[model samples]
Target: MPISDDIKLGHAERLLAQLRESYLQDLPNHCGEIENLVLSFDRKDPETVFDEIFRHVHSIKGSAGTHGLHLISGICHHFEDHLKTLDGRFEKIDGRFINVCLAYIDCIRTAVSLFEKGGETLPLENELEQLRKRFLKNNLAGLLVSSSNYITMLCQQTMGDLPVKLTTVDDGFAALERLLQQKYDFIITDKELKQLNGVALTLAVRASDSVNRDTNIIMLTSKMSIDFPAGLAPDEILPKNTGLSHALVDAVGKIFNGK
Candidate 1:
C-alpha cells in the first residue's frame, strides 16, 4: 500500500528538524556576512552587495520550502521580492534600505529560533513588521478575520495608530469572500471562528484564486496543540495571550504604513 500522506509528512518533518540544525549553525555566519556587507557597502558597488544579499535570501527561500519551512520561505519570498524590485541602481542601498537589509537578516536569524524552541527568541516580531510597513510603498487595507468582538477590539486598539483601512468579518466564509474580493495588505485571524475555522480559511485563501494570495497572514490563536494544516502556512502566528494586543499591533503594522 502507498504510504499515507500523514506518514510522509511525519518523515519530512523529521528530516527538516535535522536540516534545521545545520541551518541554525550556519545562520550566524550568514548574518555576520550581511552585517559586514552593510558596513562596507558604501565603498563597494551597491549592486555587488545587493546581489549577494538577494542570492543569500534566494537560497534560503528554496531550502526552506523544500524542508516544509514554508513560513520561513513565505517571509523570504516577500523579502526577496523587495530586493528584486531594486535589482539595479546600486545607489539606493543606504539609509532606509540598509535598515531593511539588516532587518531581513535579523528575521532569518529569528526564524531558526522559532521551530527550534517555540519562538522564545523571536522578540522582534513587532520590529520585523514595522520595518516591512515602513519600506513598502503602500501599506494599507487590512482584514480582521475573527468571530470574536474581543479580537477585533484588540487588533483595532493595537493598530489604531496605523492608517490601515480595516475590515472585519465574523464569518470565515465571508472572510474568504472578502479576501478574494479585494486586496489586503494584512490579515489577522482567530482559530475558533464560526462557519469556518481560521486555519481552514487561511488554507482556502492560500489555495484560492484570490489576487491577494501573497498577503501577509497572522494566525491569532489561543490554542496550543494545533498544527498548521498541510501545504498551508500562515506567515506568522500570534498567540492570544497576555501580549496579544502588542503582538497583533506589531504584526499588523509590519504589512502596512499609512505614514
Candidate 2:
C-alpha cells in the first residue's frame, strides 16, 4: 500500500479507538439510569417509569452498535425484547419483573466490563437471547425465509411492531424442518430458494396433516405471477416490487382477519 494511504488508515483507526473509549467511559451512567428506573416502579407511575427505562436501554444499544460493540448491542437488543413482552401492562410489572429487568441491566454492566478487559462476551449475549425467547414463548410465532437482508429489514419494520415473534432463516429446507417440528401462525418465503423452493415447501405443508397445515403462508416473488399446481397454493403470493411493503402489510392483515 502507498505510504500516504497507510498513514490515513492509521489515523482513522486512532480516531475510532478514541471515540469507542469515550462511549465506554459514559456507559456506566447509562446502565445506572436504567437500574434506577427499574427500581422506581413503586414510587413513580409505572408506565412512565418503564418507558424511561426502555428509552435508556435503547439509546445504549444504538450507540453500542454504532461503535461496533456488537455483544453489548445484542444483549441490549434481547433486553428490549423482554421488555416488549410486557405489552405495557403496569399491573404485570411486579417485584419479579423488576428483578428480571435489573438482571438485564447487570448483564449490560458485565458485558461492558468484559469488553474493557478484552474477554469473550458471546456466552452472555447468548444467555440473554435465550431468556428473551423464553419470555416470548407464548407470543404468535412467524417464520421468514429469505437471504436478502433488505427483505428481512422490511419485514421487521412492517410486522415487527405486532405481538408476533419472528424466526428467520435463509434456506427452504431449514424452514420446512421448523414447520414440521414446531407450529407457526404464519410463514413468509421467497419463491426462489435452495434445497427446496417455496412452492415445494408450501405443497409439503398443505399436504401434511401437521398443526401448521392450515396456517397462513405468504410467498414473495420477483416475477409478477406464478402458476401454482391445483389444490396447493399459499395464502398469499406477493410480488417483490415497489409495493411489497404495502402488500405485506395487507396480506398480514388479511391473515389476521382470516381472509
Candidate 3:
C-alpha cells in the first residue's frame, strides 16, 4: 500500500523542522562572518571583499528558503539587490553605505532572535520596509514583460506617478528568472510574447514555488476572447483596444490601492 499524503506531509514537516534548527544554530555565525567582512573592508582588493560578502548573503538567502524561513530569504533578496547596485562604484562604499549594510545584517540578526523567542517580528518587518524606502530604489517593485512599445509607454506613464520601481523584460524566460529570484508586487505581461506567451507565463508563475507565486498578473492580449486554462488565468485581462490605456491605468490603480 502507498503511504498516505498526511504521513508524507508529517515526514516533510519533521525534516523541515530539523533543517530549520540547524539553520538557526548557524545563522549567527553566518551573520557574524558577513559583519566582520564588511567592517574589515580593504580598499586594496575591494572586488574580492565585495564578492565574498555577496556570496555569503546569497548562500544565506538560499538556505533560508530551504529551511522555510521565507521572511529572512525575502530580506536577503532585497539586500542582495542593494549590494548589486553598488557593485562597480567602489568609491560609494563609504560611511552611509557601511551603515546601510550593517543595518541589513542587524535586521537578519534581529529576525533570528525574534524567531527563537517566538516573538512577533512585525515591527522588525516595518523597520526593514522603512530601510528599503530610504536606501533602495522603490518601496514597491513591479515587473513589466512586454515587447510592444505602446504597451511599455502606457505602463511607464501609469507607473511614473507611483512609488513603484519597474523593471522591464522583453522575453518571458527573462521574466521567469526575475520572478524566481525576487519578490514583486505585481507583473504586467504581454499575451503574445515571442518565446513564451502570456498565458503560459501566467501558468508558470501560478505554479511556481517562488516568492511570486501569488503575485498579481495583468495580461494584455490582442484577442478579444482567450480561453485560459483553468486555475491559470491572470488577475486581469485587457484586450488591445482604444480604451486600453484607461483600462491599464485602472488596473494599476486597483493593484496599488490593494483592491
Candidate 4:
C-alpha cells in the first residue's frame, strides 16, 4: 500500500526530532574524544595510529547509527574499514591519509551543523559511498543505539501528556528545517550536540521563520558557562544537573502566557 505523504512527513519529523534531541544531548564529548584520539595517534608508529583511528571511527559509527544519522554512520563505517585494512601493514601515514581523515571529520562536523540548522540534504554522499566501498568491504551493516536514546526515552516518559516530538540527527540544521515545517510550542535542546550545538540550535530556531515569528525555546546543558551564540538568543538555558523537568515546564508556560 502506498503510504500517505502526511504519514511519511509526520514520521520523518518525529524521527528527526528524536535525532536532534539525541545529538544535542550527546555528540560533543564523543567528537571531543575522537579529536583527542586523532591528536594522540603515534607519529612514529603508523600501525598504532591506524588502530587508534579505527577505534575512534568505530565509536563514531556506532553512535551515529544509534542516533539515526544513518548517512553519517555509514560514512564512519567506511572510514573504520580503511583503518582495519592497515591493521598489520607498516605503511606511512601520509598527508593524503590525514586529509581523508580530516575530510571525514569535516563531514561529521557539517552533519552536526546541519542537524541544528533543521536538517539539509548532505552533499558528501558520493565521498561516503566511495570511502565505504574502499574501506569496509567485510563489515556488516547494523544499527547502534546511543546514550541520547535514553535521554529521549526519559523525555517521552516524563512528558507523556505533552504533544512533544523528539528526534535524533547528525545535523542540527536539518532538525531546524523539520521544526520549522511544524508548529511546536516549545523546543528543548542539550549543550553537547555535534555540528550546531545547543546554543546554535536555539539561535537557529529563534531565527527560523516559524520560530523567529514566535516559538518558545529551552536549552538544556551540562555546562554551567554556556552563553548565547552571536545573533542568537534562547528563551532560557537550564543546567542539565538541575531540575530539568521543572525548568522545561516553566519555560513552556512562560512562553505560552507571553511572559
Candidate 5:
C-alpha cells in the first residue's frame, strides 16, 4: 500500500520547525564569537588571530550545513580554502579584503533571517558571483570599492530609484550614536571597529528607547565563530567573505513592509 502524502508532509513540517528553533537558539552565540575574532584581528598577535579566524570559518561551514543553509556553507568552505593557504604564514590582513569578506557575511545573515521569516527565495546570487571574482584579486582597496558599488546597485534594485542615505562612521560607537539620533529603517555595521565594536553598539541601542529596541541591526565580519552578548542581539550577523547585496536588499524590503 502507498503511504499517505499528507502524513509525510506533516512530518516534514515538524522536523523543519524543530531545526528552525534549534538554529534560532544557537546561531546568535556562534555569530558573536565570530564578531569577537573580527574585532581582535587588528589588535591580537598575527599567529593567534590567524588561527582564531581559521577556526571561526571552519565552525560556520559546519554549522551552516547542519542548519540546511547550503549556499552559506558552500561560501564558507571556499573561504576556508583561502585561509588554509596562509596557515602558519604571518601575512598582514588587508583592509579591502576584510571589507569584501564582511559584505559576504552580511549577505548570509540576511538570507538566513529571511528564511526564518518564511521567505521562499534568496536574492544575492549575482553579488556573490561578483565577490567570487574579487576574491581572485590581490588588491584589497579594489575589492572594497567593488563591494561598495555592488551595495549601491543592490539598494537601487530593491528600492527602485529611491535614494538611501549613506554615511560612514569611524567605528561602531559612532554609528550607534548616529542611529539613535535619527529614524533609520535599517542599520549595517562591521563587527570590529576602533570604538565599542558592533555587538556592544547593538546592545547599547537596544537598551535605549523602546522604539529603537526592535530596530533591525545587521553585523558584518570575517571571523568564523559567532559569540555575541546576551542583551546585544542583532537581527542578523554576516560573514565578511560572502556577497551581501541581496541580503541587504531583503532587509530593506522587510523594514519597508514593517515586518
Candidate 6:
C-alpha cells in the first residue's frame, strides 16, 4: 500500500508543528547568546564574535524560512547582510550596528513569541519596510570606476534616488588607491579602465589589505571569453551593449533589495 496525499499532508503538518515548537523553545537561548555577544562585544575578538553571531542568525534564518516563518527569515537576512559589512573591519566594529542587530533580534524574538502563542503572526510589514529603508539609507556606500563619463553619468542618474551614495573614478589605478584609503560596499568597473585594466584591478583588490578586500564588484565588457583567469572574479558582469544603463540599474536594484 502507498501513502495517500491526505496522509502525507498530515505527516507534514505534524513535522512542521514539531519544528516550530523546537524553534520557539530554543529561541530564548539563541537570543541570549546574541545579547551576550553584544554586551561583551568590546572585549572579545571581533572576527570570532561576528562569525559566531552570523552563524546563529543564519541558522535561524534558514530554519525559520523552512518552517514558514518568513518574517523571521527576512529580518535575519538583513541582519546577516549587515554582519557581513563588519567582515574585514572586525577590530573597529561599529557600536550603532551592534545595537541595530540586537534590536532586530528582539523583534524576531517578539514575533516568534506572538506566533507561537496565538497561531498567527502579527502584521509588521509597514514597520519592517521603514526599518529596511532607514538601514539602506545609512549603511551603504559604493563606487563606480569607469573611464567613460557617459557610463558614470548613467549610473549616477540611475542610483540618484536610491539609498546608497555612489562615487565615480575615471581610472582603475585611482580606484585601487581609493579602495586602500576608503571603504565601499560595492564597485562597478569597466573592462578597459585606464592606468590598469579591470581584471588587474580586481586581482589587486583581492590581494590587498584594504577594508574592502571582499567588496562586491561588477564588471562591464563588450566581449566575454572563457579564457579569462579564475581569480579575477567580479560579483556581477554586465554586457556593454545598447541600453546597458537599464541592465546595470536593474541588477543594482536586485542587489540592493537582496541586502
Question: What CA RMSD would you report for each candidate?
Answer: 13.5, 10.8, 6.2, 19.4, 19.0, 13.5
TM-scores, all candidates, are 0.49, 0.57, 0.64, 0.39, 0.44, 0.55
Overall lDDT per candidate, in order of appearance: 0.72, 0.80, 0.82, 0.57, 0.59, 0.76
Q: Which portions of model 4 miss their true places by more than 4 Å?
A: 1-20, 42-48, 126-259
Best by lDDT: 3
Model 4 lDDT per residue over 72-141, tens place = 6755744554454444755555555566666677667766776667666446655555554333343322
Candidate 3 regions with alpha-carbon error over 4 angstroms: 1-15, 42-44, 137-140, 144-186, 190-259
Q: Tell me the lDDT of model 4 at 23.
A: 68
- In model 3, residue pairs whose N, Cα or C atoms come closer than 3 Å (at least 3 residues apart or on different chains), thus clashing, are none
User: Where's the lowest-lDDT run of ten residues in candidate 4?
Assistant: 138-147
**Regarding lDDT, does 1 or 3 come out ahead?**
3
For candidate 2, the per-residue lDDT at 238 reads: 91
Ranking by TM-score: 3, 2, 6, 1, 5, 4
Candidate 1 colliding pairs? 129-254, 139-256
Query: Backbone clashes per model, in order?
Result: 2, 0, 0, 36, 21, 0
Query: Positional deviation of 11 in candidate 1, in angstroms?
Result: 7.4
lDDT, model 1: 0.72
Residue range with the least summed lDDT across 10 consecutive positions in model 3: 132-141
Report the Cα lDDT for residue 176, model 5.
55
lDDT of 4: 0.57
Q: Top model by TM-score, which number?
A: 3
lDDT of 2 by residue, 134-185 (tens): 6566556678988788888898888877767877888888677556645567
Candidate 3 lDDT by residue in tens digits, 1-259:
9999999999999988887988888999999999988887754477778999999999998888777776788778778767876748877788878788899999899989887889897798788777766764544677899988888888888778876777788898767866875668889999988698788889988988876899999888887587877777788989878888788778877887883
Q: Distance (Å) between predicted and true CA of 247, model 5?
A: 42
Lowest lDDT sum, 10 consecutive residues, model 2, at 129-138
